[model samples]
Target: MKPASSSLFALAAAALHAALIALAINGLRAGQHNVPPRRPAQVQVQLLREQPKAAEKSPATPVQPEPLPQRPVHEHKPRTIPKPKPQPREQPAAPAKTPEAPAPTAQPSPDAAPAPARSNNTAPPAPAATAPAAPVKRGVFVDPTYLATETEKWYPRQAKRYGDQGTVLLHVTVSPAGRAEKVELKKGSGYPLLDTAAIDLAKSITYRPATLDGKPVSDSFNLPVTFQLHD
Candidate 1:
């Protein structure tokens, strides 16, 4: 090869390399202008899955109510109370066998004959010689036996043992009611104990009241009470 031809080839090759590099730069600029802007990567958000609920229960049948209590049959019936009857009191029966006696008849018999009349001269029987009706004496005098019996219990036991016997006279006033109203020692016994006992016995004694014309009257009497011991 000639040196002139080699120099011409070298110059051509350098121009072709420079044109390819400019064309590649222009294609890159067009691609940049034509391309749409890329959107940012979409973020995937996954929610937590909710657990399923238990299945709903079916509705149950309603319960029946119990029956109410019945009222007593006796309460509805009307009661009829009977009244009590009064009873009669029993009476005592009279005696059955005894009979009443008949009354006496005083009428004379119709068939009897009449008697003859008496003479006028016959003197009427003289009334039996009349005697004075003795005045009835009604008085209670002092009785020695009764007084001794009454005062025997009052005798002092010591005096009786000593064989001391004495008599006491008491002036007693008797009331109409048969009671001794007052008693005093008219003549006292020699022993004062005997005299006091005699006075008390006189006051305690009761006597029948003296009567004048059938009516009771008061009177005074002297009574002697003797305390004698048996030998």
Candidate 2:
């Protein structure tokens, strides 16, 4: 319990605390040296490019094969042969007959010829007479006044309006009684109206019958009718 012993104990406690602090600082420095220095933090960087998409393929069309040509079929026909004909047999000929001889004529008397000599001077027979031929008749006669009157009466109105003008040939048959039996057109004009008018005029006109040997007879003759415009 003395003052000096107390003071020594205090100094020993202070020295132990300082020694522990110093040991701790040295351990910290040793740990730092043992760890390797950290290289700057390394970041791995890789460039990425997008790959292009593959092109789509179209479906292929199926090919059709062509058909082969066919050969034509032919039909065969059988041939026919003709048979030969038989020959005809020959015949024997008949014998010919002989002709008979002609008979002799009797002689004429001398007295019969003396009677014929007297007729040598007789006159020749008279000549036969021939009748004279009759006069030939001419063609039928048609009056000009009658033709003009019939033409004026039967003129077609349509033909006059169109100024149609042409001639028409006609064959007219006359009876023995001086009457028109038949009429036919032989040739035509270019205008149908004028041709029709001419035919009508010919049918209405009367003709004198033709005469042969002073007798009236039926006859046919060609007649021409003209349709001419007046003004």
Candidate 3:
């Protein structure tokens, strides 16, 4: 009997030990398992956006310049001139001289009216040369008183004495008033009585004075009056 009784107590102890171990292991497992507080799933967002990558700076544009201003205008003017001068005048000229004329020649006389016969007694001129002009004769004039009273005739006594025709040449110079100025006898008729008779008769005769260009001139005249006893 005693031994069975010991085995039944041992079995009861073992069951009690196993029960404690089981309780301790269950308490340890419960303590190791921790449950955090369950919150709703919350969404979180960043307040500032991340900065965008910086954009590349574009190249800068160039600028253009402006232009200048214009100027203003005005007016023009004219000019002046000069003057001229005057001239002088001229004169005239003189005249020339003239020449003289030559002399004319004489004409021949007619024989129908007979020239009174004469005896010339003047001497002839000398040479062949130019001579002075000839004297001109005067118109009809006479001294009647001298012509009548003093004339005389010739005689045969003189003719007989000379035995030739008697030449009684008387040289009588007359005055400007027609009176005999002087008488000269060149021959005595070869007889003195007849020569004296001839001279005395000639001294009383008168003649018209010789004239040259109408002026009375004094000159000598010689005449021979023949006394012939026969015709």
Using lDDT as the measure, which candidate wins? 1
Q: What lDDT score is found at residue 219 in candidate 2? A: 91
Q: Candidate 1 lDDT, tens digit per residue, 1-231? A: 556656666766776677667767777776889854343334333433344557877778778888889877765667788887878877878769777788888676888776678878997888888898876657766566776788988888888877778999888888999889988888977998888888888877778888887878898878888888875
The candidate with the higher TM-score, 2 or 3, is 2
Pick out the ten consecutive residues of candidate 3 with the lowest summed lDDT.
Answer: 37-46
| RMSD (CA, angstroms), candidate 1 | 38.7
> Which clashing pairs does model 3 show?
none
Candidate 3 Cα misplacement greater than 4 A, ranges:
1-165
Regions more than 4 Å wrong, model 2: 1-128
Please write out the lDDT profile of model 2 over residues 2-90, one tens digit for every residue.
56656666666676666666666766766788854343333333323334547767778878789879888777677776776776866
Mind giving the per-residue lDDT tens digits that candidate 3 earns over 51-169?
Answer: 45579788677565555565555554554555545555554554554565666665556655766887698688887987877879663244434433333343435455665544577
C-alpha TM-score for every candidate: 0.40, 0.43, 0.32
Which stretch of 10 consecutive residues in model 1 shows the poorest summed lDDT? 40-49
